[model samples]
Target: MVRQILPISALLLGSALLLFAGGMNVLILPMRGTFEGFSAASLGLLGSGWAVGYVLGCVFMARLVARVGHIRSFSVMAAFAAIAVLLSLLILTPWAWVPLRALSGFCFAGAAMIVESWLGERAEPQSRGRIFGIYTMVNLAASTAGQLVLTLGDTTGIVFFVLPAIFYCLALVPTAISSSASPRPLARVSLDLRALWRNSPVAVFAVFCIGISNGAFGTLSAVYANEVGLHLTAVALFASLPVLAGALSQVPIGLVSDRMDRRLVLVLVAVLALVADLAFIFLRPDGRLENLVMASVFGAAIYAMYPIIIAHANDHAAEGSAIQVSGGLLMVFGLGSIAGPMAAGYSMAAFGQTGLFVTSAVAHVLIILFGAIRMSMRAPVHEAEKAAFVTVPQGRMATPETHVLAASPEEAEEIIAAEEDRLAEEGTGPAHEAAAAATAAVAAATERPPRVSEEEP
Candidate 1:
């Protein structure tokens, strides 16, 4: 394992650096804005701008990489991102920061695509799964670490902003200086909404709801924390604990989804999320511990939904169309993301801090009602034919390349073959189907507890 990872350790480091910077950047902005007396509505707009840019980036950035090459494109994007952070620090008004946040999101998606593209080509087939697993872990840890960094000092300060900007630039040194040659043009997002709906209407509808619920919380958790009077330390915990809980929960959640109809699991999880939503709204946990507990439960249930939705969609996908299904759902999720923060912001504006969950609660109610009805309407996909579930590191932003790296081994071979077909067809066919076969999803699919074996790192 050590020998295999050593060759591409630099790429892993670069990914971690990027996440580290991004982790701080995402949380700090809302916290600082709240401190500066920015309204919940403005903060929600910030999330909207980011979601819009992220969707655009995932859809379009691959083309930019094709035209200008990975290294150059990545460097330019990173430079722009760092510049945007500094610019945001200088221009504190909500109006100016919105576009700047969008720019950061665009650059972040492009840069992440470039990094994942590099990892995709460089990884040998023998080690692809393990390498990707490590990459996922490193990035997730970095993101969590970045959020935790807030506990060390006042989160609403210039120093935190400066620190993230520095980390963003530092992220480039590994890949920029590596000897590995650039790979093929990054995977493009080819969205076939009608086809996706045809494949799984439940996935289409559920992901948009997932997008809204998760997107609102992802953007407004800090805002909610501040309004509820948690100290900065508690606020940091509020932000980070949900992610960790979600990561741990996906393993068991994936296993359960694999055993029975995933739609059933989807409904169950939605029910769980709805419960959390109500808990936040009514229980009104004033104590930091109660708030943290609810946040973790909320995150766990909400974050686990995407994997099941994607897996369920691919179960019905035509041969070699996993990428399209996953990509399409991702795009739909992005759209939901665009709406989530804005709607949640308005809700909080009208109601109170708990209004963040009110928006999420509505989404869950739709999910539950729709999921239960869908299950009764359609027979479950046979477990044998279903694409294996893979837990994704996807809460903040997930791009096409991220999906590519997340594909399972069986799916990986299919993707490479599909890539060949894509080339043979003169680039006129559907783009690569980089179906996400991520870490926890695979383990759950196989119904095995995690062990340091050949398949896992």
Candidate 2:
């Protein structure tokens, strides 16, 4: 047990530290851009760069892992991420920062994949639930810690950029000296758009819209807070508060989703998002405590949709094809993320800062229209189960929980039966096999004649 757990623990620590740095960088970027005299439009471009690179990295980093092996890939990527942050600190030019941000995105994706792959490898079936829980908690804490770090340091100085680098380096320490074996080759997920769309058109379409809407919010919310005369610390808190709320809200939202029609739940979420967007657009709350509450509630709804969409898609997915379905949806979401900031940023620049919410509201309007239309057209994909927000780390280890399932129920049943047969052939029952064997040995001893050798007789 110790042997299995030790490596997993190390990987978890590394992942948490990296997430901390990632969270810090995310929060600091808007303030950094504003200070560097970049226009809101340019800031949006910076976000676009990051999202584009992130999507590409997710698609191709598995190939990089296959080429270099896990440890080397991790080390090299970590170094690159640190270097990218340092470059941003030194140049302080928006144009330079764009490419640097993209590099950071790429490195972040690669490193996360490494850590998640490791977790996947080390996890056991019985322990997956607990492991996933611990992973989510650590991620939440790490991300929150990073956002709070901005309060301790002034964003006015170049020094703030170095902190993420320092934390990124710190992330490397736990994995560098650990004695865990390298994870096996990563399973590459191919995008099958036709199959995905056929399985659940609403899920495929909604993910794209959700990605665009949320990406715009994520990229510009800090800038919007700044425009409204929020203090730097307040801006940080406001930006982060929503994310935390969204994380918390997932539980109830997921539960509600499991019990009812997923599309109905989706429509409800879209309506809530629509209302939130309109609130941001029309109410334009001046830095009051009430505005903070509004932001939290609004954020909770928008951010929570992605996972629900994923779960809903999985519901309709051919039983064994969940990974491909999920992966295809993620890729669609990634594409939307790439487009979101660019469009919203330009709108904000042209129409003024409120355009951020305007853009978001418009997207949600489209989502609502499409969702309402789909309500009449499509049927439920599968029987809904209780919604649970079980987060598993994307570790390098091959944990049973994180693996792709077979695409059909027949395939699943066949695999289960085969496993049972194999165990029977090996003369082992599930769980307590050793104890059973010991008891059987005592009975055999009692039945056997007194020990006697023919030669001795």
Candidate 3:
């Protein structure tokens, strides 16, 4: 692991820089948009625009990496991200920034995927859990640091925009100079809705709902903080401190989830989120210290819910399908993310700062309802059969390399087939041989043909 770390340290450092930029931009952008006379609806549009590009990038950018390779793709995305930030600094118009923001999202997601892919490639199974945990910590810290960095700049000035560009440009340096071999080829992953629903309907639905709640709040939380009479520093802290807390809280939360029924843990988390949202809507705390505590509690509970949902889903996923399960849930979360901001943004537009909490509360209520519904039904999957839920680096943006684990169904079938073949070849059992042959036949029929049949028979 130490040897692995030495080679990829530069790559990881660059990833941290990229995460910092992503974090800083998230903190400042809506405020910047509002400063520039953009409406809440337009700001919501900007937020959703990023998710649109982000999810699209997650789906397709791996192919770009597969074609061009990781190093080249990383460079391309870094340059693109830096350019997008610069463009935003130059134009400073909602109309211009909207497309640039989308571009930025695309580049961020692409670069992050590259870094994670590198880490994943370097990691052994024995050390993967630790490596991913450290990666998540590093990223969470970077994002929090980025948000806090805004205290050094004037929110009303153009420096916030220029600063994130500087960080993004800085992000290009580490990976470009490192001589590590490019990561494995990128692959696409798709959710099998039927299997996922069969495994756990609540997990699937909860992931989507969690995505909506988190996405909406993530995009607009800082803006909402500002409207609620928090100063710039407090607003940044208000927005970031909770995520930091949430990341920290995951340890105990995960430990608890590991020991007991995950659904029960999820119910508690949803209830916590519901309480926080209600407080935000009604209590409207005044003291700075109190507000900090409130935000941290809210952040910890809401942000922490996704992992539980993921864990619960993995608890029942078919063997060797952890990647696909995570990917499908991620896609579902991304869809919810796009919806979250639109709903919260519109809510903010109609009802002001309080509306954000209202949107969040409603999401929590739905989640709670879903959890209840699932409790009535028997769990379809067991704890012993649970797939390992590995944590990727947080706020690192998804990239092609980072996403390779979640193979498309066809790809997964091929993988499952290959493993079966390897296992059968060494054993030499008639039953195993027959099973492999049958699986191969099924996979072959479903599998894409090696070559296109362009000529007519």
Candidate 4:
């Protein structure tokens, strides 16, 4: 393991620095905006702007890499990210910060894609799982550390902004100095609503709702924490604890999802999230310990939903189409993310700090209701027919490349063939028949012209 990791240490180092800056950037903006008297709605717009740019990066960053090459593209993205943070510091106005945040989002997405692409190229098949696991752990730690760093400094001044900027620039150093050859062009992002819906209506609908709930909380929880009168350290814990708890919960959740109907798991988790949402809205915990505990419960339930939904979709997808299914759902999630923060921000503006969870509760309720309906309408995919669940990072941080890392094309095909053979032997029931029909429909729907394609860089 040590030998395998040593060769890619530079890529890991670069990724850690990049995520640290991003983690700090996301938290500091909301805290600073609240301090500057920026309204909740404006802060929500900042989240919207970032989501929009992030989606755009997913769509267009491949072209940029193809044109210039990976290292150059990464350096450019890092530079732009640094500039965006520094500009936010200098301007200190809500209107100015919105666009700057969008720029940061775009650059962050592009830079991260480049780093992951490099890591993917370097990893051998036998060691891929270990490498990916190590990468995920490094990033989780770095991002949490970044958020916790806030307790050491005041957020109302230039220092916090400057710190992230410095780290952003430093992120460029390891990759820029490395001598490894560039990887292939980045994966293109596409959305086929009809195809995705055909493949798994529940996965499509649930992912969108998950996006809205997660987006709202990710963007505004810091503001909620601050407004509710938590000190700086408490606010940091409030924002970070849920993520950590959520990451920790995936192991057990993944094991259970693999053995039974994934939609059942999805509904169960959605119900748990709804309970948390209600607790936040009604209990309105003022004490730090109460808030932190609630946040952890909420995080555990909400964060686990994405992978369950993805696994369910793949259980129904045709062979060799896992990348398309995952990427398309990611875009759909992005669309929902664009709307989430805006709605939550307005809610808080009109109501109060608790309004953030109120908005999130509505989204979770939709997921729960829809998931339950879907569960009753369709039979569970037999255990033999299910795709093994793989843990995913948080929604905002995941890209198409993450899907590739999780499962290779060959492995995906093997899963599909094995499931198909099992269904064939068991004889097709109405549920299996419907799933087969849906798979055929998705193949036809996806046969349309490519939204975008990779070209040489």
Taking all chains together, each candidate's TM-score versus the true structure is 0.91, 0.84, 0.86, 0.89
- Model 3 scores worst on lDDT over the 10 consecutive residues at 448-457
* lDDT computed for candidate 4: 0.83
lDDT of 3 by residue, 1-457 (tens): 5775776578679878988888888877888777777777677767777887788778888668655666778888888887887777678777887788788778877787777766765555445556666677778888889999988878778787778888888888887777755554344567678888987888889888887788787788777877778788898888888778877777788887877778888989999999999998898887788888988999889877877777788777667666677778777777887888888888988997888889989989998988888888875346565554433333423343443333334444454455454444445454344434434443443443322123312
In model 1, which runs have C-alpha deviations exceeding 4 angstroms?
417-457
Candidate achieving the largest TM-score: 1
- Model 4 stretches astray by more than 4 angstroms: 409-457
Cα error, residue 36 of model 1, in Å, equals: 1.3
The ten-residue window of minimal lDDT in model 1 covers: 432-441
Q: Candidate 4, residues 313-371: lDDT per residue as tens digits? A: 99999877777899899888888888899999999998899889888899888888898
Quantify all predictions' global Cα lDDT against the true fold: 0.83, 0.70, 0.73, 0.83
In candidate 3, the residue pairs with backbone N, CA or C atoms under 3 Å apart (3 or more residues apart, or in different chains) clash, namely 113-399
Ranking by lDDT: 4, 1, 3, 2
Candidate ranking under TM-score, highest first, comes to 1, 4, 3, 2
The deviation in Å at residue 430 for candidate 4 is 53
lDDT of 1 by residue, 364-428 (tens): 99999999999889999888887878788764867887777777655555555554444444433
- Model 4 scores worst on lDDT over the 10 consecutive residues at 448-457
Model 2 CA deviation exceeding 4 Å by range: 1-7, 382-457
Q: Can you give the lDDT of residue 22 in candidate 1?
A: 90
